[model samples]
Structure formats: C-alpha cells, structure tokens
Target: MEAKTAVNVGQLSRKPELKPKRKIKWKNVLTYAAFVGPALLFFVVIQIIPFLMGIYYSFTSWNGISAAVDWVGLENYKKIFTNDAKFFNSFWFTTRFMFAAVVISNLLGFGLALLLNGALKTRNILRTVFFMPNVIGGLLLGFIWQFIFVKGFASVGKYTDIGIFKLAWLGDEATAFWGIVIVFAWQTAGYMMVIYIAALQGVDQSLVEAARIDGASNWNVLTKIMMPLILPAFTICFFLTISMAFKIFDINISLTNGGPFNSTESVAINIYREAFQYNNFGLGTAKAVLFFVIVAVFTTVQVVMTKKKEVEA
Candidate 1:
C-alpha cells in the first residue's frame, strides 16, 4: 500500500509541473500583448479615427467650421467627375508629371549608383552632395526654386544668354511643368540612388564572373542578370514614386503656387484650393476621399503586379 501511495505522489508532482508550463505560455502571450498594445492603441486613436472621419465627412455638406452638417450623398463627387474642368485638367497634369518623374528619377538614380559603385575618389562626397537636396524641406526647396526661376535666372539671363537661363520657366505653362519635373527629379534622385546602390552591392560577384566567362558583355550582364535580381528594389522604388507624385503639395505650392493660370496645378493643389481657399470643405473632403481611393488602388495594383514579377524573377 505504501508503494502505491508513493507512485501516486510522484504523479501528482508531475501534474503540477505540466500545469505550470501551460501557465507560462499564457504569461508569454500576455507579455507580448503588453508590449504591442500601446502602439496599436495609438494607431487606432490617431490614424484610423481621422481616416474614418474624413471618409464620413466626404459624403456630407460640412463647411468644416459650421456646426450644422447636411448629408449631400455624392453630389460633391458628381461635380468633380462631371462639371469640374479644373479638376480634370489637374488630374491629367499630375498623371503626366507622375510618369515623367518616375522614369527620369529612376534612370538618373540608377546611372548615378552605377557610376559611384565603381572604384573612384570623391565618390562618397559626391553622394553627399547629391543627397543634400533631399534633406532640405519641401517648402524650402520650392521657395528656393521659385527664386531661381524668378530672380536668379533673370540675373543670369542679363549676364549670359545661354543654358536655359533666359527662358520664361515659371511664367510659361510648358516650362513650369518641366521645371517642376526637373526639381523633383533632382531632389529625389539621390534617395533612389541609395536604394539602387544597396541592391547593386547585394548582387553576387560570382554571377558576374560566370557571365564574363561565358563571353557576356557588361551590358548583357547588367540587363540579363543584375536587373532580375534587383526586382525587389524596383518594387519599393516604384511604389514610393507613385505615391509621392500623387501627394506632392508643398513643392507644388512653393515652386509655382499652381499658377500660370492653374495650368500646372496638381490634384493636391486643386483639392486645397477647393477646401481651405474656397471654403468648400465638403467638396474638398470628397476629393480627398477620391484621392485616397485612387492612390490605394494604384498602389495595390502596382504591388500585386510587381510582387508577381519579383516572385517570377
């Protein structure tokens, strides 16, 4: 009987050990929640709440200052779609700018990355100089460019009639659009170059050697081997370019203020004019909602397509 009792006691002790182990798992779960809960709470409170509020207000005729809110139910959207000439024009202009910026910025950044990736003196200093413009505030960049376009160019024009200095850049619609493109490319190229540089560094040295052994030229190795391997970088860069192009405002305002008779007014500038400047808060909010959908859709499509390409590559 005593032997049986000893065996039962041993079983009881083992059972308690297992129970503690189970309780420890719950403790780990609680600990993770404790660490993550604050950030999730902040995200919901600040970002999600405001986003939901913006969507709600878009369907209403709220002047943003008035207490009385009336539901207009897509009237603002209808106006933008059907009757707003300025909105349509701004949309086309911004789309064109987006395409131009993406292509020019990526090409220039990639070229710079290639050049700097080689063995050379002063490459690091050159990188810093190129990236300095990106660190400057967008509004500040705009103002600086405005001075260049309006005053600095004029002075240069008086001194020497050469190198695009004498052209009416901001005063003319065509020139203003290209001027914005050039400024944006200059500011962003350095950033893209850094991304490309990182990707280029990650490429396998052995693969390049193998391609060379097969009598492949430098161009063939770059296009056939290196490009495919760096697809993930391309995905990230493309998405950033698209989103930034869509949301660009401070630079647009500082550079041209959507001027030259609003010919260069981007969608972002147009939305601001509708809301704060014109006091059409509802319409502005509606435009904001539309803008959100457009950006979201574009980003989603690009990600899906590029992610597929990445997987295939």
Candidate 2:
C-alpha cells in the first residue's frame, strides 16, 4: 500500500512533463486570421486603396476615360478654389441645411423619446409607428414627399382655402430648402429617438425618484437630473445628424435635383456632377478631398465639445 501511494505521488508531481498543454501558436494565429483577415483585406482593397488613389488623382488632369493620365499639380484644386462659385454656393447651402436638420431632428427626437418613456400602454405601438419612416429608402421617401408637396398639398389647399399650403413648396428656392429639411428631420428623428430611449433606459430610477421626493418640480427633475445622465445620447445623435445632413445626396437628387437655379445643391451633388456628369475626375476628386477635410474638422470639433460636456456631467 505504501509503495502504491508513493507511485501515485510521483505521477502527480510529473504531470507538467506530459506537454499536452503546449500552446499551438500557429493554430491561434490561423484562427485569428480566419476571423479577421478577409475583412481587413477587403477594407484595404476597397476603401483605403481607393482613397489613396483619389488623393493621387486629385493632383492630375485625369478625365476618367483616356489611357493617358496627365499630372496637373494642384491645378484642379486651384480651379475649385478660384474659379468655382457653384462649389461655394453648394457648401453654403449644405452648411445651412446641416444646421437646420441637426437642430430640428434632435429636438423632435428627444421630445418623442421623453413622451414614450412613460408607462403609457400605447408606447410600443407609437414607437413602431414613429420608427417606420426610418426604414423607408431615402429616394422613395423623397418621391413620396414630392407627390405630397405637389399634388396632395394643392388638393388640400383647394378644399380648405389655406394659403400656407397653396405655395409652391418644391418650385420655389426657399421652400425647396425647407422641404428637404422637413423630410430629413422626419426621417432622422425616429432613429434618434430610439437611441435616446436606450440612453434613458440606462439611467438610475432611484436617483430620479429621490429627486422627486425632495419636492423638486417635474421641470427641475428633467433638466437637472435626467438631462445630465443621458447626455451621451445627445452626443451620438448630434454626430449622426451632422454627418448625414452634411453629406445628404440621394434624397437631394431624387427630390429637387438641385433645382431653382442650383440653390439646393449639396457638396456631394456638386462633386458628383464634377466627376460623373461633367467627366472631370481630377477636379471632382479634389472637391471630395476638400469636403472630407472640412467635414472631418467640423465633426471632430463637435465630438470634442460633446465629450467635454459628458466628462463634466
């Protein structure tokens, strides 16, 4: 029995010598490669490579058709900056649109979120209804709204004798601008509401209850207690709206097509015209690069400001 016990002890002590737990470095590497390599390869090939080529082409006079690519050395950029009034007009329009879209969408979204955050029995149904518009394609939404603006409003105005609805919504420059804003805000608000709801859900109800118990008004509780807690949601929503409003394209094209004497052309539409419509690839690439830089700066500033608010909160 003693000898058998001694043999068992020896076996236990030499367990680490079996080498069965050895790491297969190649297997681990291959597993990682299997999961991530394809995505990385595609990103490099599709996005990174094209972006680099665009930068290169921006310095050339490539018409995007001929075999001969001529190097122009900042001439395209010079032309954009010096000779192109339409570019600046589009930029200004885009800037104004972005501001309107961001403010209206975020306000409406947050309002809806607040409304639906209660214990109402119809909250679920209302939420689905609100979010349904976001699922519609931008082009389709544009066309639908176009019909409503042109024909439906005319019919409603005719019957009701309302002068407000009788105005040419899409035919006029100012009204066309507002029309896009209305559509963009309507589409974007629901998506933002969902995000705000998520943020609101994560708040500590106990804090809110305690605040209410302290004889605080509903306004005070909401402004002081709830607002700070869910500020990160504001950051995210603002960022998304800002980016989307700045780069608005499909709906802009499908709805107004930058009509009424090019009053509603976004930078994206301008770049598209320069590249595909006009066949000036180099100039278009330059415009795109410039727009990318501007948007990056703007969004970076907004994000930094919002991040500071979050930290302070």
Candidate 3:
C-alpha cells in the first residue's frame, strides 16, 4: 500500500509539469499572434481594402460622391490613352524625373557614404546634418525652397557670383524640372547614404585586408570588390527613387504648382486635377489604376533584372 501511494504521488507531480509546459507553449503562440495581428489588421484596412476599392471604382462612373454608380468598363481607360494628351504628357514627365532622380540620388548617396564611412572626428555630426533634410516635410521643404528661389535667390545673386541663384529655378521649363530633381536628390541622398553605410559596414574586413595585401590600388579594390558587394543596396535605392519620383506631388504643388505652363506636372498631379478640379473621378481613378499597373510592372522588371546582377556579382 505504501509503495503504491508513492508511485501515485510521483505520477501526479509529473502530470502537473507536463500540463504547465503545454500551457506555456500555447501562451507563447498566442503572444506572437497578439504582437503581429495589429499590423496585419491595419495593413488590410488601410492599404489592401483601398487598393481593391480603387480598382473597382476605376471601372465605374461614380464621380466619388454619387449613389448611382454606372459601370463603364474600359471606357475611362480608352479615353485616357486615346483622347487625353495630358495623361501621356504627365507619363513622360514622371518617367524623365524617375530617370534623373534615380541616377543622381544614387550617385550622390554612394559618394557621401564612401566619404562618411572613413574615421573622422566630425563624421558623425556631418552625417546627422546631412540626413536632417530628409526628415523635414516635403511640402515645407518645397515652400521654403520656393521662397529661396523667388526672393532669396534674387538677393543672393546680387551679392555672390555663384550664378545658380541668378536663374529662375522654379519658373522656367528646363530649369524647373532640373530644380525639382536637385531638391529631391539633396533630400533623399542622405537617407540612401545611411543605407549604404549599413551595407558598407557589413562588408567583410577580411576581404578588404586580402585585397590590400595583394597590392590592389584603392580604386581597383573599391570598383571590383566593394561595388559588386553593394549591388543589393543599389537595387533598393534605385527602386525607392523610382517610385518616389513617379509619385511626387506635394513638392511639385508647393514649389511650382505645375506652372511654367504645366511643364513640370506629374502623373499624380494630373490625376488629382482630373478628379478634384475637373470632377471626373472615374477618369481620374482610371489614370490611377494605369499608373499603379505601370509602376508595378516597371518595378517588378527592375527588381528582377537587378537581383540577377546581385546574384551574378
């Protein structure tokens, strides 16, 4: 009887341990879900639902505030491509901006990253200063720069010989386009530089040391070893710049208001004007859908092409 009682007590203790372990496992699973569920829910509500609704609205003539939504199929799309000159013009404008912004921003950013990666007493301070522009609101930056372009430049031009201040930076066709590119690159390059700095730090010190011991020149080492290693950063920067340049609106509106005869008007601005200014929500939504498709296709192709290069490198 005593031996049987001892055996039963041991079994009871073992059963309690097993129960707590199982309960802990379930608690951990629930905890993970609790942490992750909010972000997923927000994404579904804000992004996924609106995206689907935009697609649906693109196919209908709702004017954005009507109880009577007429299904128009592809008429809006057909009109955008065939009848609207502004749509094609804005497309070209966006394409040009993307090309200029991507190339200039990436080059400047890489250069800054290389410079800042070296050990110096003031390097950290400089990096903070450089990245500060990116944190400022785009509309505020545009308005500030617009004032500089209009009033401050004129005063500065009279005093200094830089010649940059003498030109109509945001008032002329050619100058306005280049001006926007310059501002965008200036703001975004530091952000990209930070990314590049992260990537540069990840490069293996052993590889660099081996190259130095092999009597490789600095240029040769950087070009052959570092550039190839940082191809992933290049891919990310290019895609970001491309999308940002294409979607630009606040800066364009605040600085030039698509002035100089709408020469600097972007696709986003065009769509906004179509929807709100002209009250053609169906037409505007159609343009937006096309814009989304074009951006998706281009970004997908670019990522595939660049990723292949990264793999090859």
Q: Which candidate leads the pack in TM-score? A: 2
- In model 3, what is the error at residue 97, expressed in angstroms? 0.7
Residue-level lDDT tens digits of model 1 in 1-313: 9999999998888844444333457788889999999999999999999889988888888888899999989898898889899988998999999999999999988899999988879999998988888899999999999999889998998899776898999999999999999899989999999999999999999999999999999999999999999999899989988899888898999999998999899999999989898988899989988988988999999999999998988
* lDDT leader: 2
Alpha-carbon lDDT, every model:
0.91, 0.95, 0.90
Models ranked on lDDT: 2, 1, 3
Better of 2 and 3 by TM-score: 2
lDDT of 2: 0.95
* TM-score-based ranking: 2, 3, 1
As for lDDT, the candidate ahead, 1 or 2, is 2
- Report the number of clashing residue pairs per model: 0, 0, 0
Residue range with the least summed lDDT across 10 consecutive positions in model 2: 15-24
Every model's TM-score = 0.89, 0.91, 0.90
Where model 3 places Cα greater than 4 Å from the true spot, the runs are 1-26
Alpha-carbon lDDT of model 3: 0.90
Show the lowest summed lDDT stretch of 10 residues, model 1. 15-24
